[model samples]
Structures are given as structure tokens and as C-alpha cells.
Target: MILSIGCSEPLTTREKGAVYGTLGGAGLGAIIGSATGNAGAGAGIGAAVGLLGGALIGDQMQQRQNQDAAVQRQLSTQQAEIERQQRELEQLRRQQAR
Candidate 1:
């Protein structure tokens, strides 16, 4: 139902950041850990580090997204104004013919 869909909450910026950090950290950690003969420790450390790094990155990404959205909104408004003016101009031309 629409209500159920509406109730489904989106992940917070922090949550997304943490998740990304975990995945990225895990991958990097495993690679480094394997190369160094400490895969277990490497993965653990990587996850921890990644979580922190991801949180920071995610926060920044969210901010950028917000800024981009604002810009898009402004552009849309300007486009609408231009369209309105064009319509008005056409209307005036039609009136002058009468």
C-alpha cells in the first residue's frame, strides 16, 4: 500500500556511509592482509577503518548530492519562467491579429 511504502524509511547518511565503509574496508583489508600473511587481522582492521572512512565519505557525498539537487531545482524554476514568458508572448501576438 502507499502508506506502507511511505512508512519504509530510507537509510540515514551515516548508515549508508558505514555500509560503504565496511564493504570497501573489507575488500582492501583482505587484499592487504593476504599479501602480508595476516588476512584475518587485515580484514578486521580494514572493516574498522573502512567504517570510519566510509562515514566521512558518505557525509561528504550526501552534502554534494544536496547541493546538486538545489541547483537542479533552480534550473527547473528558470526553465518554467522562460516557458511562461514564451506563452505570454505568443498570446499577445494572437491578440494583435484580432
Candidate 2:
């Protein structure tokens, strides 16, 4: 009998941080706006501030993605090199056997 299993991709730390930060920002914005008499202006300013903060956070997530990609490329190159060396070694062994 053969069994197959599926695995879900894990969320990176940066992604997790961004998700929590967005939720926190929205909650704080609402609370701040409600506490102050100028709810409208407060909301507007909050939104702007929240948007800027979110963008900076999103930028950080993108930076992590870039770093991960660089590491993956390096690993792939190393794997390819190992495979090539193995094939060459096999060919040399076969030649000696004949």
C-alpha cells in the first residue's frame, strides 16, 4: 500500500507580523477616533497614518521574500552541481568496469 500526504506552505515571520500589525492598527485607529470629538478628521488622519505604516511593513515583507529567493537560488545551484558530479563519477566507474 502506498500513502500520500499533502503539506501546506508555512507563513513566514514577516507575513505573520504584517497581518497582526494591520489588525492592531485598525483597532487603534477606531479607538482613537471614537475617543476624540473629531471622529471624521481623526479617521482620515488615522487612515493615512495606517496606510503609510502598512506600506512600510509590506515593504519589509517584500525584502524578506527577496532574501529567501536569493537563498533558494544558491541552494538550487549547489544541488545541480552535486548532481553533475555524481553523474560524472558514475560514468568514470562504468568506464573502468568495461
Candidate 3:
């Protein structure tokens, strides 16, 4: 009853941040440049700077997210191991009681 499309993977926050930042920076840069009487140059410079800064920030954000995910996975593994040990201990205790 339902249809699926290609590449269901969504864009990460880092990518979104980069795109937004680039657009915002360029727009702001052009406006400021226009006041000095050079819209074309202003826009070009603005867009370039914006793109670079945006990409850098996005990359950093993605890295941080990856680190956080790794930590979470580790914690989950530890917790599971602890639970397993606890269960084993409980079984041993029961056998000793009998």
C-alpha cells in the first residue's frame, strides 16, 4: 500500500548547519558590500567566505556528533555486560543456597 523512494538517509545536522550558514553569511556580506558601492565583488567574496566557514563549522559539528554516538554505544555495551554479570552472580548465589 505504500511506496518507497531512493536514499532514505536524511541530511545530518552538520550539513544543514553548513548550508544555512553559507546562505546567511553570503547575504549579509553582499548587503554590507553594497553600501561601499560594489555589489558584485561583495557578493562573490561573501559567498566564498560563507561557504568556507559554513563547511568548517558543519564538519566540526559532525565530528562532535560522531564522538557522542561512540560514547553512547560504549555505555550501552558496558551496561549490557554489567547486567550479564549480575545475572550470572544471581545464578551462582542460588546454587550455593541449594
TM-score of 3: 0.83
Q: What are the per-residue Cα lDDT tens digits for candidate 3 across 9-91?
A: 66666666666666777788789889999877787788788878887888898999999999999999999999999999999
Model 1 lDDT tens row, 1-98: 22234546877676688787887898899999999999989999999999999888888888888999999999999999999999999999999999
Clashes of 3: 0
**Candidate 2 C-alpha lDDT tens digits along 1-98:** 01112325555445445444555565677678789866666666666666567667877877988999999999999999999999999999999999
Q: What is the C-alpha lDDT of each candidate?
A: 0.87, 0.69, 0.79
Ranking by lDDT: 1, 3, 2
Q: Rank the candidates by TM-score, best first.
A: 3, 1, 2
Residue 38 in model 1: lDDT: 94
Predict model 2's lDDT versus the native.
0.69
**Each candidate's clash count:** 0, 0, 0
What is the alpha-carbon lDDT of model 1 when measured against the actual structure? Answer: 0.87
Comparing 1 with 3 on TM-score, the higher-scoring candidate is 3
State every prediction's TM-score relative to the real structure.
0.69, 0.68, 0.83
Model 2 spans > 4 angstroms off: 1-27
Candidate 1 colliding pairs:
none
Q: Residue 9: error of model 3 in Å?
A: 3.9
